[model samples]
Target: MTEHRCPVMIVTSMPYRLAVIFLAGLMALLAGTLVARDAHAQPPHADPAWTDIVVGAGDDGRRLSLTEGHRLVIQLPANPSAGYLWQIEQLDTAIVARQWSSEPDYVGPGDEITGGATQQVLRFVALGEGQTTLQLALRREWESEAPPVGVFTLNLQTVGPFTGANYQYTVPPLTQPPALSPDDIYAEGLPTHFSWCEQGKCTPIRDQGMCGSCWAFATTGVMEAVIKIQDGVERDLSEQYLVSCNTHNWGCSGGYWAHDYHQNRVPPNEPDAGAVFEVEFPYQAKDVPCGAPHTHHEKISSWSHVGGYGLPSVAAIKQAIYAYGPVSVGVCASDAFGSYKGGIFTTDESSKCTGANHAVVLVGWDDGQGIWYLRNSWGTRWGEGGTMRIGYGVSRVGWNASYVVYGQTPYMPIGGATQPRVRLFLPAIARGGGGVAPDAAPVPTPTPVPTPTPTPQPVQQVPSNGGFEDGRVIWSESSQKGWPLIMNTGSLVIAPHQGSWASWLGGDHNEVAALTQSVQVPSASPYLTYWYWINSADSCGKDVARVLVNGTQVDTYDLCAARNTGGWQSRGVNLGAYVGQTVPLQISVTPRGPVDLATVRRFAELAFEVVGLDYRDYVVQDARFVRPADVDLLVGDPRKAKEVLGWEATTSFEDLVRIMVEAELSNPENA
Candidate 1:
C-alpha cells in the first residue's frame, strides 16, 4: 500500500474528526433503533366495524329493519368514545341513506349513536319489492384523538309483502266443564243464615314456606268438607300428593287452578313415597278409597275458624282467605294478570287471564278498600308470597252475580238433613299460644266522632328539571349520598380531557360515597331533573348508572346504555302528572356486573344538567349540529370547527393529548 499521509486538516484537528465520527455513529445507531421500534410497534387497527351493536324489538315483535314501513332499531354498546360518529346507508348502491354526524339527539330506536345502547326505533316502509340491502358505519367523532374502533356493516334485506299472521295463541274453552257441586251457588249478597267453622272445626293448610301449592291445599280443604258433609266424617286430604306428584302440572312451586282438580280427579293417586304429613290422616271419604296412609298429616283445624267469621262480599272473601284459609272463587284469565303481584285489587284492567286461563283460591280480602285476596301456587316469593288480590266486584274474575264455585263447602246452605261441620287448625295454639274462638266475643263497634272532613288537596304538576324555579337546586350535597350533580343542557362540550369520570362510579374505588349537592323540584310538578357521567373504562368494565325522579326510578343505563366514554350528555324526562306536591331527583351508579380491580383504574366520568323547558326545544337545537357532510373531518382545527359550529376549538389540543395519555395509562389493560 502506498504510504498515506494524513491530510493537514485531519492532522491539525484530530479531536474534531473523532468527535464527528462518534456523533455520526451514534446517530446511525439511534436511527436503526428507532426503525426497529417502529417496525415492532405497528399502528393500531382502526376498524369502524368493530362496534358493539345491539338489536332489540318492542313488545310488538317488530325489530328495526331497512324495509320501508317496518321499524328497525340499532343501539351502540356501552359508552362511546368522544368524537364518535356513525352513518346508515343503503348497501346496494352505496347511497348514503341516513347519517348521524353529531351526538345522538333522541335515544329511541334509531335517533341515537354516540350515547349508550339506546333502543332506536326507525320505521321504514318497504324499499321497493324484492331484496334491498343497508349498511351501518361508525368512527371516532371529529377531533377525537382515540382512533375509531367499532365500525360495522349491517346487511339488511327487504322482501315480500307484509304478513300479519304472527299472532299469539289463545286457550279454547274446555270441551266439558268439570263436575261441580250442586250446593255451590253464586249469590249477589250475603245469605240470611251463615254457619262457619268454629275454632276446632276445620283444618288449615300450611303454605309450605315459599312453595306455591295453594291450589292443592284449597282442593284438599274442599274435599275434607265434602267428606264431613256426606259421611259425617272429617278426613285430612293429601295436599302434598298433588304438590309432589303433579309433574305434568306445576309442583310445590306453582300450578294452574285446573291442575289441582285434574290431579285429584285422576286415578291411582301418586303420593311422594318420602313426604310426611304434619298430622295423622283422618277418616277416608266415600268417593275415594284410601291407598297407603299419608306419610304425615300436615293439616291444621283452627285456621278455618278465623277465616269463616268474615262478611260475604268479595272483600270479605279475600280477607278470610288471607287471614285463615284459601277461598275458592272464579277469576277472568286476562293477559294483564300474567305479571300479577299478590294483593287485593279491583280494576277494569283485563287482558289474557280471562275465561279461566287459571284458577286460584281467594285466601283474603280487604274490606276497607274492596280488594279480593287470592293465593297462587307460584311460590311465596311470587305475588306477595303466594297471595294476590284482584279488584273486588270489578268483574275481574268473570263473575257477574253468578260464577262457578268448587271448594270444600258452600258459602250459603239450602235445606239439608245435616249441616256441614268445618274444622280449623290454629298454629298459634300449637306454638304455645292461647286459642281464641272465632265467635268467642262480639267485635267491638267503632265510636265515630262527629267532625268536619278536611278539603282534599289539589294535585300539582312537576317541572322537567324537578325544580320549580330557575337556578333552583333540585339536589344538593347535604341531602343525598352517592348522587351526582347533573346539569341538563342542549349544547355541551364533552371530551376525554375533562377527566375520566363515570356516571355511576367517580372515585378510584368506583363507589359513589355521597353527592356534593342535590336539586329540589316542586311537589306539584310531576317531572324531575337528573344528570350523571360515565367513563369509558368503567363502562367497558361494566358499571351502570340509574336515574330516579320523585321516588320513581326512570331507567338503568349501563356503560352500554349511557354510551359516554369521557364526555357529557343530557336527557329530559316527563313527570308532570303525579299526585305528589314535591319531588326529589336522585342519581345512582352501581356496577352492571362483576368488575376487576385493575379495570377500576380506568375510571369513567358522569355529569348531569337539568332543563326546565320541554326536551323538544333542546333536542331540536342539538339536532341542528348533526350534518352528514362534516362527519369525516378531524375535530378541533380552525377549519373543522368553522365547518361545524362556526367556532374554533375552545378545548386546547395539548390538553386533549394529556387526557389521552392519562386515560391510556390508567386503562386496566395498560395498567
Candidate 2:
C-alpha cells in the first residue's frame, strides 16, 4: 500500500496577509471530512459453518436466496481518490444485519493513493427467513443533499439454513491502457485540420460508462455546444434526464436520440420539454424511473435531421456543424473503435463495423485530409482525450446527422404559476377477519354460535390515525398561512397513500407545513412505515422535508432535485431504541424558490476564474461535492474582509482559481 498524503495547503502570489486569510477560508471550507459509518468494520457473526456469496457491479436488482447465518458480500467498483465512496443506503435490518467490525479488502494497487481505482466491499449476514431489499449509493459524502452518481439495489430472500463452505473469490485489479501520444496521428502527413472548439469554450467530453446511453449523450453534446456558440453561455444539460425520464424511448438499454427529445416531452405536466441541468438528476448509468427532478427542463424550439435516413454527405455534415455548432451522427462502434487510442481510426472489415448504431458528435472536419473530428462519450482516457479523427464516410461517420435549432425565447417554468401540487392516491385501508367463528354451532342450534373475541396480542402498535384517515384526529397539524396539513379530496389528482386523505406537506413558495403525532414505540415491531410523495418547483437546500423523532432530526429530504416518488412510496424508520417510550414523530416541509441552473453555472465559472483555473473545468464536468443552493449561500463582502484581514480581493475570480491551481501544481509532492 502506498502512503496517503494530504494535498499541501499552499497559498502563493497574493500578499502574505491576504494569502493567510484565504488559506484559512480554504481550510474551513475544504476540510474533506470522511463520512460517518453506521456499520462496523469487523465481521459481526463469525461461524465456521457459514457460507459466503460474492457479488459486484451490474449485480443490482439480483434476487438471491441466503440461508440464515450465511453472509452476502457486495463489492462495488469505486474510486475513493476521486472523492466518491460506496456506502449502504438502505437495508432491511429485520432480514439482514451489518456490523462495523469487518474490514473491507482492498483489491487495487493504489489502495490509498490519490486518483486510484478501488473497490468498496460490504458484508451483510442474513438474519432470519424474510424478504428484503439492499440499496447502495456511490457518492461524495459532502454532497449529501445531492443525488448519488451511481446506485445499486438488490433483493434478498433468506431461506432455511444449510451450512456450506465459504466461497472464496478473487477480484481482478483495475488497470489503465498504455498512454498513446496524439502526435503519432499528427505526424502521419495529414491535411490541414479545422475545428470549431475554441480553447476553454467547447463543452467538456463526458463518459457514458457501461451504459448504452450514447444517443442521449450525443444529443446533449450537440445541444450544449450549440448553446455555447449561440448564447455565449456554457450549460451542462442532463443526459441522464433523457435516459431515465424520457418514456418514449428505453433508457440505458438503448434508444435513439431523436425519440428521446423530439418524441418525448416532459411528463405529468410540462409540455415544452428539452434537457435539464446535470445537477438536477445525476446519471446512474442504469434504467431509473422517471423522477420529478426532470420536470424543470430547458426547452428547445426545434431540432431537425441534416439529411434523411440515408448517409449524409461530408459537406452537408460540415455545413450543419458550421451553422449549429456540432452535429450528432450515428456510426458503428466496433472492437477497433473501442480499442482506439490514437491516430486516424479506419477499418476495412465490414463484418466488424456493421450498422450505424452507436451515436457520436461531429465537431469539425478537414477536407484536405478527408477526415472528420468526432467527440465520443467514452472517458478522456479513451481515444485522443475522448475524441476521434476518422476518414470521411469511414465507420458511417455521417449517418443520421442532426442538430438543434436555438430556442427563440426563454422557456417558462414547468408546473405553471404555483408549485406543482403534491397529489396522492391512497387506497382505503380494510380491516378483515373480526374473529374466527367458533366451530359453527356444533350443536346445530337455531341460534348460530357468536364469533369469539380473541385476546389482543402485545404486538407493535401503529400510531392512531397514522394514515390520515381520521383527518388529524390524533395528530397535531400546523402550517404557514393557515394551510391545512391534512388534505382531503381538494382535487381529482389529490388523494391519500392508502386512504381517502393524506398529509400534504408543501405547495407554493415560502410555506412551512408540519404534521406530528405522539405514539408509544412498539416493542415487538419497532419499525414505523409511512408513504410520501413530493412535488415541488423548489431547488435543493432552499426547500426540504425533515423527519424528526422527539424533536431530533432523523432523516431529511431535499425537495428540490428529489425523485417525485411517482406516487406514494413506503419508507421505514426503526424506533427500536425508543421502544416503550412515547415520542413525537413529525414531518415538516418547507418549500422555497429553486436555484437557477444559469446562476449556478455563472457562479462556477467565476469561482474557477478566481482560482486562475479554466472555467470549462468547473462548468461541464461533474463536481466532487454539491454546491450550496442560491438561497443558502452567503456572498462574502470584500469590504468586510478588508476590515478584518487588512486586504480585499484584488483580482478577478478566474485569477484566484488559476492561482490555486498553479500553487498546487507547483508543489514538490505533485512533481
Highest lDDT: give the candidate number.
2
What residue runs in model 1 are displaced by over 4 Å at the alpha carbon?
1-68, 71-240, 243-266, 269-325, 330-344, 347-349, 364-367, 393-395, 398-671
What TM-score does prediction 2 earn?
A: 0.34
Could you estimate the TM-score for every candidate?
0.25, 0.34
lDDT (C-alpha) at residue 60 in model 2: 82
lDDT of 2 at 540: 48
Local accuracy of candidate 1 as per-residue lDDT tens digits, 1-671: 32111100000001111100000000010010000010121223322221222353222223234433343335543211111234433444321133211122224222111111222222123333454445443432222343444444444555445342111111111111121111121122322112223212344433332233434554565445433443455565555555544444445333433223332333245343322332543322111233543543222222232223212344344333322334444443322243445333333322222222233455333322224445443345445555564544443342321112223434333333233232222111211365434223322323334223223123223222222112223223211122222221211122111111111122223333212112233333322222223323232434444444333344444443224312112222333333333433334443332221111001111100121222221221111111111111111223334567766344433344446656766799986
Residue 610 Cα positional deviation in candidate 2, in Å, after optimal superposition = 26
